[model samples]
Target chain A: MDPVGLSGYLTVGAVLFVCGVICMATKRNAVGVLMGVELVLNGANINFVAFSRHTALGLDGQIASLFVIVLAAAEAAVALAIVLNFYNNHLTIDVDRAVELKG
Target chain B: MSVPELLNHVLHTDLPRSVQIFAPELVLCVTIIALLLVRMLKWHHKFPTSWVALFGTLAAFVGVFAQFMYMKTGGELPQMRELFEFWGLTQAGVGTAGEYFTGLLVHDPFAVFFRLGLVLFLVLVQALTILTGIPDQEDGQDFYTLMIGATIGMMLACGANNLLMLFMAVEMMSVPSYAMVGFLKGRRLSSEAALKYVVYGAGIAGVMVYGVSLLAGVLGTLSIPELGSRFELLMGDQPFSLTNPTAVATALGIMLVVVGLAFKLSLVPFHFWCPDAFEGASAEVGGFLSVASKAAAFALLVRFALAFQGSGEAIQTLCLIFGISLGVVSCLSMTLGNLAAYTQTNLKRLLAYSTIAHAGYMVMAISALMVLLSGSADPVDSAACVEGLMYYIAVYLFMNLTAFAVVAFVRNETYREDIEAYNGLSAGGPMTKLLCFCLLIAFVSLVGLPPMGGFFGKFAIFASALKAGSVHWFLWVVLAIGGLNTVFSLFYYLKVLRAVFILPSADESRTVEIPGFNGAYVALITLPILALGMSWVMGDLTATAHDVAAYLFH
Candidate 1:
């Protein structure tokens, strides 16, 4: 009856979580990191729906998880849009190069 | 039933309350499709296309307003049910839906209030776009679609009953905005802004997702109301107690979830991309990004915070710590934003920092929200903070959009967009100068000054902090600093106002004619700035804020 079988979902979530961490730590594409965020959300989303099916707490788990996924997506889209415009202006996709306002 | 048959069954028959609760988003979906069809037509001039976009928003606004007026409340049922509603679902607790959309969503006052605020802002943004004519610059079909689509995503973010829905709504809103950020594709700074926005967005979103996984895997539920119910049931003696390892893990999940949501709100540590993106993007996009998006994110925050509300020491301690620290960090953000604004000669970049300062104000309201919910606080005091934040955001939509309208107006003529360019506006254009003075008052309001709603907004939050008696010093210090910052902010506002009214036009011979529609639009926005002084109109805000407090506190 365990949809994620605990460890399987855990492993997927772990991989996604680590991948997102790695993406945030390493990627310079900006939009690529956004994709990584989407992946991380998908991983977590898998866990939520999985748990909803598996546990006594029932549908609430899946519902809250659904809200998280939607908000993350909205944030990502706007951020990516902003990044696209930023790159249009700055002529670079690299994050380290965007420190002009730091002073 | 077969797959298509079952799908039709859910579509054709009675809709659950959760779907009805999300009615505004449903209306927007219809508008988006209509906009998509408009993209095919070759317009002789772009004004009609823009009108289609504008009226589409107006229509959507009407729909949301009507839905809000007719919305059924949970805990108490409405006398009658509407034949049509969000996602085609019936009203919750009033009509049935197999535990409210199979427990992936709920129809509560909390989500409804947030959704109403979001729709109001969306209408404002659409109206601003119409008034300003930002579409005059390019082929703008995709622009309108993306704007509407992103807005729908924002509404969904407010009502997401399931984590999966949350992620989907977030992406639905994010993707279009990414494209929109880069919509002015030829501009160097616009592209740079888009890139920075995307990177920052991805990083925070990823962090939040990891947080989500932790919550779901440990606590085994993603449904918010159910999570609230189960977390309440947990321990049977003391609620939300982590002393039981399972509860502890759930508590940890809640922390991580806060991290994800905070990234959206642009709280410290996650606020890096805001200034850059704001600076790099155009004024209209920047304004939209700053206000509408943040309001939606706050909707998520309010819901999630209440979801974890319990009688446990650990959870309450977490709330208290976060609330207090967020207050200090908010002060820092405000200082940083104002100081940054002072040095900027470019009007767009200056407005960018102003957006940051406004964000700090919103966060300040949120921190107060946390304090009010902790049961240890007085109920009456909590009500002030709740109402204050709600009214602040509502007034903020009108005030901020007015400021952006001025920017758009000036930008349209001569295509120059720097503070220096505004130097001669007064002599050349009287109406523009008048509008600039009105916007100056708006700036004053944003600074939380009197005769403007911003003053009461600030007063309410400060009063709540005083009433709570827990963060007395923090509140007083913030007030002192906020008062000082208001003075500092006045200098820059006056600087812009002087350019518009006191200074001579760079060319003394030229006079600018005010277009009828644009003039009326600015005039329309002007009324509310002064309305802030009327206590009768302002009195309702405190009551509404109390309702917001009651939802979370109850």
Candidate 2:
């Protein structure tokens, strides 16, 4: 298999997407869901570089992906902080238990 | 030829300009590394580590300012400066001469402006961290390290010119933020918020990756400059044989990728996590997410939109659709955000809706940019919109901070964020009353009313839209709706205002005690809310925006 082609990236992306779905489905810990984010980003990244190689996305695809990474970090930070605060009032970070928010 | 060899060749041509363009952020990188090394040393709780981060941010601010001045000084030859950043870049990078990393990244007014924005936000967050002091439960050392680490990622995001850089920058920033969010792991809601963010984030990332793969498969290269060269060709051609399969699959992929980015911006349909996350989080955390994260995401949106603009390709057309979709989503978002805000009494949730509405405002700007992308190149392309977004976010930071500070103050006494909890707040608490008034200014600004920084920012954006959207009445009507949404927004923004001031005090006889210097920290954020609105200090910001627009749209 030639290492630098479309199928390669497509496969990587598919694997990542599936993995993230599974992670989102299975994760009970708040931080574990965040791990899914890391995996998900890695999946997109593979696609970005793949495109950088095979298509006219050129640098912009890569650039857009890069911005995505930065934002994910900012989002994670605030999200984690909020989660911590939530636990300060509650005792568990179980997704199922967050029902107190349902007013 | 191989990728590296080809990239090297491109780099050779870009070197001279690259050095100048990369200077501002490069300066921050050096300072950040130095701070990291400094933090590794153990001092008797007297190392003044927070001051170190503050100083670095300020220096980065000064460096970015200098870089902006340098570009404005040398690159003002309107026609030439407008042509390409490679020509106008003049920032003196540190340690060695700076150079472009091919056209993947470039130094120019726009990058300088975003870098400046990052510096300000970094300083803002650092100040909050410093004033709050170390949480009794956590180690202060690693916290600051992660904070600086995340700031570096943001700085890099502003400079990113290609896809690889974008991804790396996002992860670089996100990893640290995730840690920060879980800083209070003992608390369940905070942990839950972190979990929701991660799951949602990962899911969105998957969609984005699939989309990027499709884009790469179809386009052949991820370099935006190269993509621009082939924009018409890629978008204009049918890649998937003599069948409709090509457009269907590729467009779907592109939409998927947008979902990833859209998730970050909390664009309506993908915004399920926002209210809960805001409610579950700390005020500081909420404030940072509401402003900094949005600013960084807008930068990505501008870059992506610009990359695919025109071409009449399905993807380019997809971007146009996304723009309209984003606008439609934003209008609903603002209404939902503001109107829902009226029903809820929890300050954080109200602010959450408020944050959603602002995201809608930004997306609306992006939507307008799409129309501009679809229309002609006259009155310029989407640059005006980008510039408007930058200014809008600048206002958002200060206004949001003021709002959050007030909530933090109230939280200390009552530990409550409910609307009725604010009853008679002004009865005996003088500072709380003053803080409430400042928050009123912030709310007015958020709704885009006059004399505040928010109004000026919105006015500039709307005026630009009127020009770009003029050719298409439908586009104009959509933009008009965006304007109307802001008015409708006022009703909800004021509801919170009423809660803080007009409603009876939650504690009539007892007042919350001020926590030393922390009171001052809350007051300090108000300076920018008033300054940028009054002194036109953001003139440089506004001027620099012209270049940011040109960088992307041109």
Candidate 3:
């Protein structure tokens, strides 16, 4: 079988992006929100790689995908570190508890 | 040349010049490494990390100065006449000539000038950190390291010439700031602020990257300068259509990208995290975010908006759409900011709202810029718009920093942040009164009163808005809103002053005697707020701003 078309890959990416955004909006767990962030980033990554393969966008797309992966990991590390601090202070990872600074 | 030959040529020919242009960044990177090493080796015990941070920042400032001097005088030490010619730092004879790092970054006058500003700002913030004792001796190295790391990111953001560079630069700047916001470890509010900041920041960044993917895929390029011509080809003379994937994708991508930038600028509808972060974090961190992050974001926004070069009809329409929408956002941000600030009792939260309002003011200049560009005539007015932005940022740095510094100082002495807590500040005697006076000056300057720096900044922006109003009638409305918001802002800023001098403290024990050095520090920072307002001295600032605007257009 031939490889999937650009539209197919884009459809998959769009689904993932939507799921990720919805997750970010709905999740109360800090780590769950982080997972949503990763999903959104990877969704974008899939689009970048697909473009590099199927379209005239050459190495730049692949390079961008690689960067997205690295930066996603970096973001996760930082988010988790913050989560650890939150857990330490409140003994919970529930973002709802982190509202001491509200108006 | 063949592909391999082209790659080889870029590697050999471009690499050396890129390093030369990146000298200041190199200094900052070296400083970060040195700071870490000093910490691991316990050198910070003998030599303070704050000193190391300050020394590194000063060195970077000197590096920028040397480059500027070299550009101006062709590497020769200046004689008296040449010195006179270059004095007041007009950026005379400095063209837009730049060294490019392949496609990553460009070292132009705009980049250099902002880098200079960031480094100078770092020097002062480092001093403030030392004086305020935000970073105790045990953690000084970590604090300075994060601070310097963030500065490097900001400098890079100012010079990013490619989409990849832009994303990386923004992340680089933001990551350290997240750490800095939570730097006061074991504090409940600090960690909460960092969590909120990271979640929101990471989510927006992902959205931005998705937008980037769509844009780059459709356009088949990530080089910003190349996007314009490609846009002209893909969008030229095309009527609006939902059926056109290219057009829809481009529009979607642009709006998504703007969302990311707006989050950083803390414009309304995307400004939810700003006040919470400010209220949770220390005043020092708040000041850093308000000034440095906002400046870098404005720089990125200008570069992104201006990247659509040339005079194609399709491009002109796109510019107009951007202008009108930006105007609406500006109006919303200022009105919301001023109204929300009215009932706030926390000083930091109030300033955060003030920052949002000021962002609205700055974005008005962008709208003016776009409106002027849509005309494709009167490039001078557009340059004035850019100059207005640069000038506003320059003055805003001092005005906002001084306000936050005063807050940090008083918080140190009294551990209070509420307006009601500051009752009868004038009754605390001369030192306390002097601090009160400085706060008054800062608040008045923030209100854009005469004889203060903010007046000139606001004046420059409002003047450009009026200039653009000649071409587009809507900008007159933007000008009207800007003027009205300035009046609205005055009530809240002065309420702090009134609390300080007018309202009497019911508890006499609340008044604390501030030390002489802290009062002197307050005066030191406050002096520039007055100096930049003087007519004769402001000539240099306008000249510098003009030079930067000219270079950007080039």
Candidate 4:
């Protein structure tokens, strides 16, 4: 039987990270960009948890992933609140619409 | 030891001592909680939330002051002396004093000094906010809550020992600032600044966390001190070159972390949000963000940089590359910041660019420190670099707040934000004359003129950079660019003074009225800039800075 190895987990994490970066760069909606941030964080979380399986990392990686999850939640909450406030004033979620403070 | 026994041992032994050492931060946390509870109480309406916040911050300052005195005077308090002996926290030689909260934070001289500076700055900023009346009675709770919350985050950032703590501390500081920038409801520019800040901040933070994960995974630890040894081990017996896969990976991780820190520090290429944020937010909030956040970020950068030290050949090579890169960053930030400030007409936006320029000056100290470290020469040169950085922050706290306080005072009367509005400011009554006089002093000091604290600060940094250049010639270029940027910065700051004193009043009918007491407030903050400039008056701040630098290696 074929077994999934560390390289497979790493490859998946890399793909998730690339996708998240692209999402963040291309998305115009503030909320959509926030979702991209979540994806990026979760990709890192996957790598952390995967590394926890290694003997050297032991439980620290798992503990780090847990911390990442909690932080990501806090970040998302703050981002959403800012987006909601932006929408309340601008009447749109598009980040481009909020451009009063240009150089 | 069994796992349960270890847990029990930590719970009993470490927790109590950690709490004692972290009393100042705990006071801040209690302030936040108490603020919320007070808001819930009906009496909050009668007693202004500003008073509550003022008292809370003062109490925190007292705690920090007590701790600082204890450290400075060899534990004059009996309780502190006992505590230090019991926890093995006393400085036997001059490295890390102790680890607190099980190594999530360190109780070193560097951290303690920075925490003391941050709390002191917070008290001053709160006083400015109250004077400017930016947060009125009705919304004072929300405003003070966020301000205190953000300050707590910054204090933590200065002391963070673990990667997780670093990331969380930065985010905690940033989140509240984003809200504060947008707190002016219905203001279009304010909301825009908040949006820009949050989006850029979140993206940068995500990248930094990914970097942290990669570094931790490869190194098998999140503790900063562990990274140095692990790095030496990972490059064992290999030729010192960037082509090595491990070095490449580690560099990528570090550069990612640098990106996030640079954004916080508002280095160019990442400084787009800074001017806009300052322009949109009130001068008071801008003052807080500029001074508090920058000082804390500088501390974090110093800590992060020092944590990568090792005597191995490969480590030396990596540190050299890192130092050179930071030198380049310092050059770019200073040159770009000064050039950009030349075109800015809005007073707040101009000051924002000036803040970026000063950050460049501060980063020069870091570059020198790094260069000296990588060379593995005399540690005194590197120590002087840190001293210069700390002294700059100390003076900058006064210089910048004075500028912004004047701006806020003028805005209250004239509602004018552009430079042209300052025409004939000297022509106004006694209060306006006093404000103009204060502004002149602040701007002159900012230009690093002799007799102002900024001059000595810049002198210390440039001297350190020259010492570094004597070791590594690339730092010469950093020193040259710093000199050139100082000249460039002088032009624009003088431009403001010209508008205030030389030019005719743009409008004849409008008279800006300032209360007489406000003159005293302006004087109170601005006098320090003048005093710090004179070496004889302030004595040498370098002694205190040396104390901080002694703890850097650990």
Candidate 5:
């Protein structure tokens, strides 16, 4: 079997990104939406690492992926905390319920 | 080339210079730590955290001001050198323009200008918080910590030179802001706003980072300045076409990245979160998001868009496309923001739409800059484009802040934020009249009236756009749309003013009496808008903005 190439890795990354976007669009649960965000970030992480190995990006891509991981974690923490606050107020984590400020 | 040599050079030479250039951000970091420590040590009983935050912000502002003066004076000022030395900072890279921290960030007049504005804004916001008393003594430390943290993120955004730095800076600015939107704990609206903001922000950020990865992989570089040269090399003599796979990938990546920035700017189709966020958040947070965050995002957008500029025909074509698209987006944002604002009864929501409209005007200036730069126009036209943007941002800081500050003060007095709350405001008392007068100035300036800063800001932007239109006729349409939007915007602003000066009080017994101190605060902020409209002050500011903008082209 041939080794997985850069194109293969990018294909997987693109699929993941598409799935994440679809999930974010369809999910009504706030946490599920946040999970979609995670999937999207991880997809980018895959591309970064694959680029680091296959392209002239070298260490920069790897470093960027590392930073993205840390940032994603930070973002998730904040998102979950906000979701918790929403839950506390509305007694549910459904984003549809957060229509108090709509125009 | 060995490890020891690289380490020695970085440790001794690069580190010190970067630190000196980064003094303001470091001071803010220290202030954040101090706020946390104050809370941890339970010292809030004796000393107020707001004063601590204010002093720290003032110190940061002074540091940035010193840096601005040093750059403006060409670093030959003796007193400035003495001040740097007193702070235990070296003079290395103090007055010079270059990349610092291994080229992850830049120290230039443009960045310093934004830094000065952001830090000064931090000072003003801290003072406003103290006067308005939103985050009481119990929550002062948390509020200041989050506020300062977000500010540091914005400062980083102004200086980011690498794609990674740009992404990090944006997140740093955004995450804390989400928390700030929900700072009014137990308030359903605040929590909902925060939740919506975070979900939308996270999704957009993820998409943006994916675009960054694609661009990095395709171009084989992540440094912003290097992207253009790499693109030139990649395309060589080939014409730009959709059929080319590399061109297709590059366009997709650029569009995705722009989507993220448009979210921050609250341009059309991405502005759904803006009015909701502002209406749900407190007026103070709303003001911060509208002004400071917008300023930082604009700075980042300028840097990011200009990164693709080069002499190559393909690159120029690409930039021209970006310019036209941005012009279209600017038109849509302005028209929609104004048309939507006409029906808003909540004062904060109206300002939100106004914020979106003002953002559109600023983005139009950027569109002109991109178009002019891509064409063979003289360098001065492009510089004027940037100068227009800078002047507009400087004036906008005051206009938006005063408007939101009035909302906050009224909310404090009446516990209401509806336009009806401001009815007969001018007839109440001296203090209420002062508030009414300040709001009138803010709204009139926002409508681009003369003898106010917003007038000059709008004129500079429109003049520059006209210059760009001479290069490309599409910008002419944008300029006309901007004009119509400005005229259309006047009615909504007057609608609010009519409530203040024309309508009788709904409840005459409920007179809105602001304290003398808060009245002075409003007047203090209003003074700059009035003063900037003066010929001499506007002239000096124009020259300063011109200088800063000149450096970008070089």
Candidate 6:
């Protein structure tokens, strides 16, 4: 069998990205939404790594993915802290419950 | 290059120059650390963190001011160059403009201009917080830390030259703001706002990065300037269409990235987070997000869009489409924001919607800019489009700041931010009257009436859009809609003013009494809006903006 090519890796990344967007759209749990965001970021990361290996992107793609990883982790930490704050106040983590400041 | 050779060049050459060019941000960094260290060492009792933050921001402002002067003077001033030499920062290192930090970012007149505005804004915000006392002594360190960190991120955003740097800058600017929106820890609304802000922010950021990956992979590069050149090569002279997979992917990437920026600017469709976050956050934080973040995002937007500008039929077609789409978004943002703002009872929510509308107006300038650049229009006219944007942002900083400052002070005295809370403000004491007058000027300017800065800003942008209509007839329609929106906006602003000046006080026994300091602060910032209306001041600012805008084209 032929080795899995760039298109195969791209197909996987696209699926992950589509799934993540769907997850974000459907999920009402704040943490679930955050996890969706993570999935999307990791999907992008996979694309970056695959492109670095397969294309003329050279080291830029790999370096960008690393930065994205660090940023995603930091974002998750801040998001979780914010979620904790919400839970403390409302006694739940459902985003639908955050309707206090609606128009 | 061997490791040692690369290290030698970087250590001796790149380090000094990059550090010098990056001095203002470095100063801000040290300030952030000092703010934390003061609390860590338990010195908060004797020394106030607000003072520390103010002085640090002032220092950075001076640094940016000097850098601006240096760039404008072309590093020819003997005294200024000598001053830099005194600090061991060479003329070649500080004032000279080009890519810095291995082309990850740039040091140019445009970036310096935005940095100057942002740092000065940081100083002003610090002073306002000192007066308003939003964060008590215990939370001062953490508050200023987040605020300065965000400012630094915004500064970087103005200078981002690479796709990676662009993403990093946006994230850096956003993360701290998320924490800040929820700074009032005990408030349920504040926490809720932060929750919504983070979830939306993270989701959009993910979509944006994914777009970045696609663009980078398809183009095989991440450098912004290279993206254009690579794109031109990829397409050759072929017409750009969906049938071409490369063009399709590239267009998708660009659209997704713009969506993320649109979210930051609170344009229509992606603007759901704005009103909630502003109403949840304190008025002071609202002021920061509305003014500083908008300025930085606009700067980044211009930079990103301009990266695709070049001469070719296909490229021109793409740019024309981009410009038209931007015009559509601008139209929607303005109309939606103004219409939504009409019914808002909460002052902060009203201002948030107003922010969205103002963003729409500013984006109109950019749309004109893109269209002008796409066509073979006069370079002078293209430069004028950017000039309008720069002038608008500068005027907006003062207009919005004054408005939010009034809200903060009133909230302090009355602990209420409803329109009803401001009823009969003009009937109060002298200080309250002055505060009310300042709000009138801010609101009037926001309505783009004459004899105020917003008029000139709106005039410049509308004029540019009219000029762009010569290139494409659609911009004329955009301009007309913009003018009508300006008229539409006047009623809501007057509605608030009527409440303040015409309506009777809710309680006959109670009168709002604004402190002298807060009243003076509002008046001081409001003076600029009035002063900028004068031809002399407007001429000077326009010239400066022209100079900065010219840098991008060159």
**lDDT sort, best first:** 6, 5, 4, 3, 2, 1
Please report how far candidate 1 places residue B328 from its true position, in Å: 3.6
TM-score of 1: 0.83
Ranking by TM-score: 5, 6, 4, 3, 1, 2
In the range B1-554, model 5's lDDT, one tens digit per residue, is: 99999999899988888998898899999998998899899998899999889989898898988888888887667877876555554346666789999899999999999999999888888889999999999999999999999999999999989999989988999999999999986999999999999999999999999999999988998998888788889999987899988887888888888888899999997999999899989999999989999999999999998888888888888888899999999999999999999999999999999888999999999899889878967888888888999999999999899999999998999999999888888887798899999999999999999999999999999999999998799999999999999999999999999999999989988788999999999999999999888768888898999999999886
Interface RMSD for each of the candidates? 3.9, 4.8, 0.8, 1.2, 0.6, 0.5
Query: For candidate 2, what is the interface RMSD?
Result: 4.8
The sequence of per-residue lDDT tens digits that candidate 3 reaches over residues B81-162 is 3542433222222222554777688767677778778877888888888889999988887888888888888888888888
Question: Model 5, residue B279: what's the lDDT?
Answer: 91
Q: Write the per-residue lDDT of candidate 4 for residues A1-103, one digit (tens) a residue.
A: 1288777887888788888889999999998898889888888888888878863677888998898889788878877887888788888889877777765
Best by DockQ: 6
Q: What's the TM-score of candidate 3 when only chain A is evaluated? A: 0.95
TM-score of each candidate structure, all chains considered together: 0.83, 0.82, 0.95, 0.95, 0.98, 0.98
Consecutive 10-residue window with the lowest summed lDDT within model 6 chain B: B82-91
List model 4 lDDT by residue over B1-554, tens digit each.
99999898688767776776777777888888777878888557878788888888888887776667567766656756654454344333112267778889887777878888899888988888888889887788889999999999999988889988888888889989989988886777888788888988998888888888778878878888788789899899885776888888788888888888999999987888999999989889999999999988898888888888878888877788888899998999999899999999999999999999999999999888888888896877778888889888989999999999999888888888899989988888898899999999999999998988889889999999999998799999999999999999999999999999999897877667788877789999998888887755567566777777765643
Higher-ranked by TM-score: 1 or 4: 4
DockQ of every model listed? 0.42, 0.36, 0.84, 0.71, 0.89, 0.90
* Clashing residue pairs, backbone N/CA/C < 3 A, model 6: none
Candidate 4, superposed: residue stretches over 4 Å from native: B2-8, B77-96, B535-537
Q: Rate the local accuracy (lDDT) of all candidates.
A: 0.65, 0.67, 0.84, 0.85, 0.91, 0.91
lDDT of 6 by residue, B437-554 (tens): 9999999999999999999999999999999999999999999999999999998899999999999988979899999999999999999898898768888888899999988887
Which of 3 and 5 is the better model by DockQ?
Answer: 5
Candidate with better DockQ, 5 vs 6: 6
Q: How accurate is candidate 1 locally (lDDT)?
A: 0.65
